[model samples]
Target: MNGVAVGVFVFFFLLVTIMGFAAARWRRAKALDNLDEWGLGGRGFGTFIAWFLIGGDLYTAYTFIAVPATLYAGSAVGFFAVPYTIVVYPIIFLFLPRLWSVSHRHGYVTPADFVEGRYDSRPLALAVALTGLLATMPYIALQLVGIEVVLQVMGLQAGEDASWFVQHLPLFVAFAVLAAYTYSSGLRAPALIAFVKDILIYVVIIVAVLYLPSKLGGWDSIFTTANDSFNAFNKENADAIAAGDAAPKAMIPPAAAHWAYASLALGSALALFMYPHSVTGVLSTRSRQVIRRNAALLPAYSFLLGLLALLGFVAIAAGIKVENAQQSVPQLFEQEFPPWFAGVAFAAIAIGALVPAAIMSIAAANLWTRNIYRAFINRDATPQQEARQSKLMSLLVKFGALAFVLGLPKQFAINLQLLGGVWILQTLPAIVVGLYTRWFHRWALFAGWAVGMTYGTWTAYGVPLPGDPDSHFGGPLELFPGAETTKVYIGFTAFLLNLLVTVVLSVVLRALKVPEGVDRTRPDDYTADLGDEGVEAEIDPHEPAHA
Candidate 1:
């Protein structure tokens, strides 16, 4: 069972567990009863901590496993993730500082909170709150998938010969630790743990990309082997599909998939920062300037992501064999590197899941507590009650994610992420556009979200997985609606439809003189900093910077 690797993995896992729990004391809150302290790290993380938290959160276990796995399984199309991250940063760079400004000014914790403040509409805010939670469920499942892959590779997964309890125990143990630390420490646990996760990941990827190519001849040999392998694999899939023997899969995107690639990249880029988790990271920072600095600095991760994506080609050069492509990186390391170092790398990948998972669950819980629970269920819930509700909801959210991965097929986890991208993208017009201008009527924006979400979900549910009884929750790409031959990213298609409807409905609703909600934000609120006169007293005044 790879005892040395398991030992090393266990060491790092325990270390992070300790840090997670201790983080409750690290940034010891002014009071533990408030959402600002518990859910958002007192809204005071600076440039350095913010960088690590955002990096560790975005380039997660799923990215570590999926990007390389996609490259290993498919060709250039897998590479779209690199460009997607790149584009997303510039977009966030332009917009997130503004979001930070307004959120901090008004003490808004979630994007839905911002929408509620801007539109003064509880129903509209509720829609966003629900969408964030729905999208996040599958996203959290993807993190578990990351953890599960690492465990399986470490020989911890229960096999056919093992009892069900015996096999699933490792996952439960790891997740239980995650939930406990996250519940106790809230956002601080992930913020503190991100440092270790990012460092280990950078070391592992730098060492692998530089070392693996030489071990397998060189870059030329690696690409040649990868090209040859993918060509053969695609041919096999094509033959099997012709024989009605299998679902079609490919190593590289075909010429026709150009639309698929571009749309997926653009759509994902737009949808990424819209996740409540991403906003949670942004809001946790101290100021608009921190968000701007992060936007400029985050491309370094995109650089790492680009290098990490190349590891797929390395797997081909190494001729690693695996039933699941997600195992290619772990299995490759197992084959080529010493067990101890491989253990460190595997720990980096597996523990990487925890940081993002913690933040995402917390973010989702905040949405539930602030926008749903407190807003609707208990209008007079005190800060302590809100914090308690958020903490409890965080547990439920994490367990829901855990159940998703354990109870369902692995493909369900994968498809759920795809659908997540689409569902979250539907919030762009209502949230991102609202940051710039309040010209779009709130009702029209809500209508657009509903229409986009409905179409995206319906089409996604109808996509066949060839042999499976239920349709594939095939992520971003789908058959271009009403056009059979061409395929496109469903997120982009839905987003466009959403924009059109919003524009049309705005004109119609304006003509009808429909009542628009009052905006509570000021003109200067979009650029307010932590200590600015307009900024709310969210960050504690005397909190020492860990400088």
Candidate 2:
């Protein structure tokens, strides 16, 4: 084991653990017995705090591992993440502030809560809540995967002959710590810890990108080496490439992949904010202006992400090699940096996992307590009861994610995460479109959601790994139906079909005189600010929801 690196990693882990539990007192609320405080940090974070919190929530540990890993593995299209993040901010600027306003005005806690309030349909709201829960599980598992990758690189794993429990003891301990602190501190845990997480990430990435390139000749040398490596791989695998048993490596995508890159970027951009955790971060802000300001400010992370993606090429240039591409960057850090600083990088990745995992668990738990439990099981539940249920459910959610990592194959989590993007994107018509207009019949939106979920999942299931026809969900891109040569993100294709079905069905349902549920929000509610008539300084869970 790398003793210095492991020691440094442990010290930082303990520091964050202390911070996580202590966060409940950082922004001390009058009571922790309400959904508003426990689930959303009292919904009063201003621009600065929201920026770090949302940034920490969205740019996760798996992203740190996976983005660079893709490039290291010679998939040029993997850099779509940089552009995906860029495209998302403008979209967030346009719609999310409106969502923030309405949610604040109506005391909505989850996106599903807003859908139910907007359509007055419990079943549709349940669908949204369940989808959020399902999509979030694999995502939380991916965070564990991130932590696991770092631990492996740190030499924390037991020998190959060790029992499964012995091998994964370190991971289990990390999972326990995450669950305990998140249960105690709720949204505040992640919000407060986000400050440290974002700072460490920036410091590490900036140092890595700036310092490493200079050490390895320069940017020009790095690019040339990476290109040479790809060409060598292609030349060696010429037969496999021709037979479609292996993919050709490229530093830049060829013309045939242009649509693939664009579609992944566009699909991912649309799906990012739809995640329950993203909604949770947005709703935690103080006012609509906070959301808008963060939208403008968050793009800076996109810049960081672009630089971070280059580290994949850097790994190639540095002559780093590993069986798992996810370990390439971590291995690079270990080899290049002194043990002490390498530990800091590992800590950054592990802590990065903690922030998002905490937020996602809390977000998923809120969906359960509000949409499923309060809406169905106990309609008359009190605010304290709701808080208690969410806190307990948060523990269950975290452990459930832990089970996913421990019991299932690692590849399963990664594949489900890909499907998670598509699954979560299916909620867009109901959530994003509902933010603009209520013209969609509630039933039509429900049908569209079902159809989209079904189609996206089925199509993704059929995509084989490059060489293995039997493998499923090998990647997110698929040949666009009716277009032989062009491939697109399955989520985008499914989303279009969803919109088409919703529109056509709405016309038919309207002519059949099917009921459209009453919208509980006023037109003005979507534009209201903190001091406006119905918008409260602190939302009162006891108060009746807006009529």
Candidate 3:
């Protein structure tokens, strides 16, 4: 059972648990009974804290596991994560500062809050809120999947013959602890713990990338071994590949899959900031300057991600073999590292899940409290009431994620996350484009979102796994409609169709003089800084959201 490794893992886990609870006291405020304090840590974090928080939030446990796993599985486009992360920084540097400005000026806690204030359409705002909630569920589940993979490699999971509850008892205990501290300390828990999380991750990745390659006969040997393995598999499976019963593995994507690779990278970049957790981290910053500065600095993690992705080849070189590719990295650590350091690696992964899961649950809860509960259920809800609702809903959100991991097949998690990218990207026309112009009719944006969501989901559902035609959502790429040979990311294709529909409908709606909802913001709102008029160091929860 690797007692020394398990002990080290437990020690770090306990340390974070203590920090998570103590975070409520770390940032003492007047009270956490308001969204600003509870959901956003008083919106006073500077560039340093935001850098770690946003880094810990965006680069999740799933990235640690799945990106390497993709390479381990020999998916041609597995390394798309590196390019997408590179692409996202420039995009956020351009627009997220504007979102930060408007959100602070309006006391908007969630993106839906911004949408409703901008468009004055409750239904459209509700759609954005619900989409964030739906997309985030499977995402949180992927974090749990990360934790589960670590536990399995550590010999912490119960035997397969054990009852399901017994089998997942450790996972449930971790979830309960995460839910408790997040509920008690709110955003402060993750914001505080992010410092520790990022440090451990950096240490682990740096050591693994540097030391493991040397131990495994260097990078050249690693790549050669991985390529040879792929070639061997392809040669053995030649008949099956020709009969469309198996995929041909490759070190680099073939010419035929070039569009698929590019589309995945671009599509993921466009979708990254649209996630609620990403917005929550941005909105919690002290100023637009902090957002901009962090946008510039966060690319350091992308460099780390590229190194981490190469570890998949390292695992191959080390002769690490597991039926599940997701387990390869964890298994590699167990086999190669000392028992104690292996524990640290496992703890790094498990703790990595905690930070983002906390942020995601909080982000989802904020959406429910602002757009669903207050907007639809209680028009006169107070700030305290909103905070209370969000706290309760955050618990429910985590539980929903727990249910997802328990009830669903874990193999499809990567696919579901891609599907989430497709679903959340549908909101870009409303949120990102709305930052620049209000030319889009609210109803038209809403219609476009609907079409994109429907098409993306249906198309993803129709894609069968390469060797299993009966399976669904087996991958993110599909044959481009009307181009029999070209395959592209479904999200990118869906987003283009959404833009087309939104633009056409806006033109028609304008010609018909459709009622364009009132925009409560001014041009200056998008450019406002911390010291600007009506922009405060900390948000006033009592102020009317649209005032």
Q: Write the per-residue lDDT of candidate 2 for residues 1-547, one digit (tens) a residue.
A: 7999999999999999999999977767657788888899888788999999999999999999999999999996989999999999999999998998999888899999999999989999999999999999999999999999999999999988999899999999999999998888889899988988999999999999989999999999999999999999999999999888998899888888899999999999999999999999999988888888999999999999999999999999999989999999999999999999999999999999999999999999999999999999999999999999999999999889999998987876798899999999989999999999988999999999999999999999998889998998888889976887678999999999999999999999999999997889999989999899878775444543222
Worst 10 residues of 3 by lDDT: 538-547
Alpha-carbon runs more than 4 Å astray in model 3: 538-547
The residue pairs in collision within model 1 are: 74-251, 75-251, 75-252, 158-167
**What are the lDDT scores of the predictions, listed in order?**
0.88, 0.92, 0.92
**C-alpha displacement of 187 in model 3, angstroms?**
0.5
The number of clashing residue pairs in model 1 is: 4
State the TM-score for model 1: 0.96
- Please provide the root mean square deviation of candidate 2 (C-alpha atoms, Å): 2.2
TM-score of each: 0.96, 0.97, 0.98
